[model samples]
Target: MTVIGIAADFDPPHRGHAYLLDRARDLGDEVVVFLNADYTAHHTPPLLPYRLRREIVLELGADEVIPVRGYHQRFPLAYTVPVRVRLMAEEGVDVILDAGPSRNLDRLREHVERVLEVSDLFSIPPNVPARNVVRWLAAVEYVNRELGTDVELLLIPELEGYSGRKIRAALRRSGYSPDSLRKVRRHLPRETFKKLERYLKARTPPIARRKELLDVLNRASSYELCSIAHLNTIAVREILRGRPFRSERQVWGALRRADYGSVLTRLALANTECRVTSDEIARIALSWCVERLVPENQSPDSMYRRDWFVAALSSHGVKARDADRLYKRADSYEEARRLARRRYGVDPGVPRFETLIGEARVSDGEYRPAISANGRLGVVEDGFQELRATAFGATLLRYVLDDPFVDAVIRVEDEEARLIVFPGDSP
Candidate 1:
């Protein structure tokens, strides 16, 4: 079978990305796009997560969208290209596609049996020639070694876009304001722009303010602080050590100047070492739930102004179990379900999951269950279905659903709706 694969970071995918999909669709029966993971993106890691990026590309009509975990690894790097290529081969990618200027031809031939260069980057505004050349050459070398003679490249110049760099810069400079978003809208596809707009409105700043970080750390755990502080675990951990649990004064001294996320965390925790209350913790947990609902939009605080989280939890009608157990983070979704089961005896599931009774069960180490939403028990398969699971309400459903297990039975108590999940579970 002939399969086509294209690789890109597509941070907020532009029209150029859609052009590749359209062309690839014409070239092969299946077109798969390999997206760069968050850590592997060309610019700062504040770029969208791999899942979100894959979702955007899939919307572009690619048959499949797989994230390239460590995008740039090759000879003289951390890992060998052959190993990576073998993995792609396992996915049945017969040809890998790329795009660039006409001069990229010579180097393109070295990788893959067939190569497709979509254009000479004509639609792109001119930029630093030397840097583009270096990046282009390095990509060519890496792709050549990665795909070798087994893949093919075909050149078709039809892609157009506002360079990714420009969009990111505009977003940063504008502080994601209305006019800036409007300007950005000119460069992205309609659906892509919609997602981007939501992201801009809801996402945390790529860098945290020193004052804001200090305020949040005071009431948040090292883990919670990481999310609020927007720092990695290591940095957060480093800022959280001491004798008799170091004083805020000492921590502040150590954090005089550091990554915004860490600095923010230390500052937030400065005086909050032992002052965090249950209400504050509950607010944090609800915030986490909001994050799960809209992973791209990190503004869980938005739900609070309207009492949305509390109202939703109250609707679940949980009884006979302490809801606080739900707020504890789980290492994984499956673990979250397990913790729920331990707390509630019978598994909490949508009335229309695998059986009419809606008893939850683990599948592939994941909780695959229907969720009761909008007064209807609906399961989000490839798409959402409003109908019952089966005529008898007991029909076993196919396909795993990824909505939160807590969706079906939330308990609103103690002035907060504590979401149930296992410890270590990220939204």
Candidate 2:
């Protein structure tokens, strides 16, 4: 009699597993399924234990199911490969039909003849209800090359309903008979159902901070400190680390000194150490910070506060055009200060620049607005107030310029620089 072998993680043996196995039974007289070991799934842990998963497979109509265990092996799948192959040979099976040409099946096929591979017959562009058709076809080609056999492979498109993980969860919670696999039925107990529901409710996708900068930035408090230049300097470093912040303070610290250009430059290097692109991280982080610190509800248009509009503009270095939309009502200094107090918790009359200068014992007449040769707005030298303002502008300015807008900026000798803006882009 022909013997067929199936290898799968079978994390929860849903309708898809049964659908594939039932088709395997039709092609061969006996079916042997090798369940993936618990440790084998370390890279991607399965929801259920291997033993229970094997039992679930049998209940779904697998003829013979076996536990294939190994420890301390570089390739555990490699060890189980030979064991299943020998079982096929000892059974005196002439022909073999496998669910798909997996690594273990390839090992078995190397020792056998008349190997048949059944794979994704139903897929898009040319076939039926499955998405991974081409992938299965590719696996068959790989097996054919390794085994040096003709390998009669059939592609079958089997339609299946219900995912294994959801089914496992449903059964455990309802305390229903696991045999209710064929259909959705009330087999689990009420208490089990409640517990399962609670467990599922608590289970959430891990917040991927390292995946994007925005993801990290969005989690910070509205009052978190931020800096565009800081982000630009450290974009590559943070992306390489790819770990979530332990506290709001950590995220706040991360928001320092970044701009779109610096982000683009760092990402352009494409260092293997940094898995994510610089732009992606910057965009995510910028968007996240903006969303919480300066939301649409608190936007210039929604709330006419000049200080807020100025602060937001300064933080991102927003131009008059962009700032105009956000704070259309703030046409004068009084309005700007009034809005600033409501939004930024700053007293517009407090005179931060004057206070800092007074503390430094600098004369007010010595406070001259520094100007660039290009005849554009420039930051003051030793104007500690300008340093703070520039830092704020570094956070809010929407444009990145070649000219530094701070108290002191590094420049290559005789290298003409562009006017630097915040968010690191030109208006």
Candidate 3:
């Protein structure tokens, strides 16, 4: 049997995902799919829990699906490729297909028959228009180029662009509206969606939770209503957002997780005509609120940036603790780019670092030194010297007091305990 293997996060398999699996099947006599375990996707939270998601893929037409655990303490995605390759090798895979941009193709090719890149067809051909083809493709190219690989791009114009991310967002919406569910169906394969609907029905909270919220909504402010209804204050505030529930669609953003019951309970309460399903609420929310990543004009100091990032995320409904993790990631991204530029004149477009990246918590105007490759801490002192970037105690200094025009080089020495930079230059 000619076995083919492919790996994906597949938190919830959508139409585009179905296309890839179909292609994988065409490439070999048998197909095996590697499902990324939940809690492994670094930046995004899973829409469904681990076991539920695994069950979802099993229904989505994967021939042989196996969920794998993470091996690395950090940078699991990078490490995931090796684990997949090893497992697939044992399964006698003839070709390991990589359709996504994010994967270590170079390393995988060494062990497998060959790492074959599947052409992602569809300018978003069917189901729903792609979430954002330009942005998603740019991210893809950046990853491949950073790793110095030339993966073939295939064009299958008939295949549609089905985004699981959009589908998941659509699911987290206000009252379960039939219209919303109808819209979602357009983007999902009929069989897959039918199964999904059945699963969603099972997950809806009982109606008792709805009646409790309705009574509280009748007489109290959102804050007071939480205590009266035994609901979480933050979710209630988010659902209300300081305004009365004027329309179900208008408030779907806040209603996504506002109640345990179906979103329709809130909708029905807003106006008794609501007869929606949980699936509809999600679809409406996705059509209304699109996710965008806007770069922050970050502070030079890392700790201050954390505060700024937290405040920004809080306003958009992310909790305080989760916001902290996001801030750390942003800081690490910036720090890597800054360090890489100072050392190697060329930028790889994305970062893969060896040093443990962290943000300094306090600002004392002291030059934050990076531990060199050889394990020596960098320091700045007053003297004239020059050295290599990766050397221990070797430093890159900027913004110092000196004769502004004298063109002085900051002295860096491996053996020196103190780093000396007579100010005047800015990096």
Candidate 4:
């Protein structure tokens, strides 16, 4: 049995996605899709939920749909590509099908190899059309070398005149009404258009939590705001100075003043909405760090420390090559920070909280008025002290806030506290 693989967000299944699925079906007996989770690669919520997107893909002829989570929220494309390639390799995928700008596979592979030779974190050459095509090819070659996998890449010409941005803009402009759906009908498949119409009528679009995001940004202290991902020191200062934001636009203006581009600004807002801290991002990155990056004979403790250092540096915008250099020269995280500053003039973006000392479990609590407008404030007992806490994220705020019992790791700074709750188990 031949297994073909594809990785896509498929935010809302469109004509391009349908084309890819059809191509993969023709080339292989099984088509396996690795779909992005609720969040897209740009660290924003998709227009549709993950379940809906998966259902549409299956309806379009995917044999299996696997959720690719954790990495996309924090890491760059360079870090994520290798992880996806490894997932395909592990899933027994024989060939990966993708749409690229050019049909010249050898040329694309050559471009990827050159970029990989320089640094894995470096972006593909701008002159190269369809950089993601080169990225996937590079990742496959790297994974094959490191893990001895024999997966192959198959590139097909990308279908033009289908744009997710254009479709999304039309939907938003028309308030996601049936009329807007009809306006962008040609960009979508027949099934996609029908399903989307039903979805728009039955359920609200998967838009960002603007009210909750604004409340957090307006109320959070500079120190607390700085802890969120994509918010640098300058951004924090700008946000703090422009407190009491009445609308999302005001907050965006502050970020613009802070020199944040469109994507980074959106990411900062999304992170604030989820209350995603730098420490949490570092922890997530550590989980994704491939074992093959390190030697086999290294002790578990040493390997963990090295991975932690790399993850931390990556979160701080340090390139992979520089992070590796710092890992070899420094004996501890503090030493690594010093070395990075001395050599590369890198400033530690977020203040590192103390390591997880112990665990605490929270019991039932009633709703109380707090920082977030959604009334999610509560009290959590950590060791001998009780700390005031506010929970964010859709599922967390909905269920855990009022649940009878939950286990979490509490990290505190001064009187402010943030909870790190891992699903299914206590950290």
Q: State each model's CA lDDT, in order.
A: 0.43, 0.37, 0.39, 0.65
Question: What is the TM-score ranking, best to worst?
Answer: 4, 1, 3, 2
Residue range 1-427, candidate 2, lDDT tens digits: 6666665666555555677778888887887776766433222234455655666677667788766553201121211233334444454433444343343444334323211132111111222222222333333443445433333445445443445446555544544333433344233223333333443354421211123434444442211111222223233234324335554335334333223342233222221112222222334333423433222222222222233355445554455454544344454546655665565555434222111211112333332222222222333435323222344433222222211111122121122212221221112
TM-score of each: 0.40, 0.32, 0.36, 0.68
Best by lDDT: 4
Worst 10 residues of 2 by lDDT: 351-360
Residue 86 of model 4, lDDT score: 85
The superposed Cα distance between candidate 2 and the true structure at residue 7, in angstroms, equals: 2.9
**Candidate 3, lDDT over the whole model:** 0.39
Model 3 Cα shift for residue 296 (angstroms): 31
Model 1 sits at a Cα RMSD from the real structure of 20.6
RMSD of each: 20.6, 20.9, 18.9, 10.0
Off by over 4 Å in 1: 70-86, 103-149, 158-161, 205-427
Clash counts per candidate, in order, are 35, 52, 22, 0
lDDT (Cα, 0-100) at 96 in candidate 2: 41
